[model samples]
Target: MDNDTLLMVVAQLGGGSWVWRRSGGPGSSFVRHQALGSGHLRRPHAVASARLGGHLYLGVADSSKGGTSTVFRWGSGGFYPHQTLRAWQRDTHLEFLELGGRPALVLCSAARRPLVYRWSGGGFAPHTDIPHVPDVYAAKHFRLRGSVFLCLTRFLGDAKVMRWEGSMFREVQQVPARGSMVFQPLLLAGHRYVLLGNDFAPSRVFRLGAGGRLEPAQELPAPTPRAFVPLAVGHRHFLVATSFKGATQIYAHVTEDIGT
Candidate 1:
């Protein structure tokens, strides 16, 4: 595949295996098939599917159960697993970002005192401990524009958004910082807006403000967030490859009233 062409990862199913479909040419649609996800005792806790240097990089869990220092990256007909830490952990999550003008894969371990890992020098290395965060016991990284952010849900503490500022993460500017970070947030609306949650009442909306700030923009009228990521490109195209009740679905649309 050409470096300029994008091989959009369609679905991540069956542990390490991924379902990918190439998009291009005229009148072409998403072609589906399976790859990897074989020969494993432990299920993947975190997964990162990205194209770095003309080849796809698939990050997987080195162990199925917690309490093991293991992270695996796949490419070129093989798998490379590394133990960045000594102790065991759980819910190893991965988010790929461009850090310092290079491909950086951030890993967050789910432990009593969780840790963060970065992929560099062709292996996994410790980046730094997230400040002001006692523990990111369960957190996921969100990339808006080029910066990386984490929405951390803490135990017995308030959940906050941590922004990566080339050095470390700081608290995101939230209007109601003390309120509940309830909804399951997903990047949507051409990556400009984020669909926060599907609460019992109504859906809350948030738009990324200038200087990497998150401001309460609008409400979704309904309470359900149907998509996870933007399926198609362009400002007019609205799409989401989402999972609802353990089932996979594709949602797309073209909008006319993009900006007001």
Candidate 2:
């Protein structure tokens, strides 16, 4: 979202669309600007938006059984359909990242291998696939100790962490997980940490170790955890965890301790 515009994408059960709103300032009310989509969009699952070279790019995923996903570009007067990409049974997440100064899009699915597409001046093109990443529900990219890493969360098996090895991403570590869906990265007291959420197991926190590995730090009480985020109020910091089948929890920051 920019200072003058707010972009939002909606996933309709049958058809999906993207909307843009414009506001006068920080506290002003926003008015609808425009909406765009294609008739082929069905069960849209995720939308990733990015701005490059003064233009906006949007990647939308459709999870319908045989529906194809599409990328929209801002042109002429509004967003126009750009590229249509094939997705699997369920496209769960879409992430936008810049690797080696090139814009890229990462798509995650539950039945097909995770795909990465690079922006090729004219349009986005298939770049590579994350091998063995079936059942992937989410993907996150973070930098640790001057190195970039990609973490893929699976809903049936172990979550894998891959490091960008100059040319491509290579698997570096795996964290035991079951029904995992999200990986939330946070920084606390000069240290990096990752919170793993599983749909059928207890949530966990992993700390960056000496050799770039992640070590178990703490276990959360979340049953069927789904999402996590770091929050701050006044001078106190807190960690919030949301569960799909249990109560939401808030953890306070207690020097050297990851709140209970």
TM-score, one value per model: 0.62, 0.86
lDDT, residue 241, model 2: 83
Best by TM-score: 2
Residues 1-260 of candidate 2 have per-residue lDDT tens digits of 34456555555675336464545656676564556675757778777788866778887877878777788888765777888886545787888888887888888887788888888987778888888668788888887667777888887889888887766778888888877888767776456888898776668889877645789988887777777778888888888888777789888877756689
Candidates in order have lDDT scores of 0.51, 0.77
Q: What is the C-alpha RMSD of each candidate to the true structure, in Å?
A: 5.8, 3.2
Which residue runs does candidate 2 get wrong by more than 4 Å? 1-3, 14-23, 28-32, 87-89, 188-190, 257-260
Candidate with top lDDT is 2
Weakest ten-residue segment in model 1 by summed lDDT: 174-183
Error of 2 at 160 (Å): 0.4
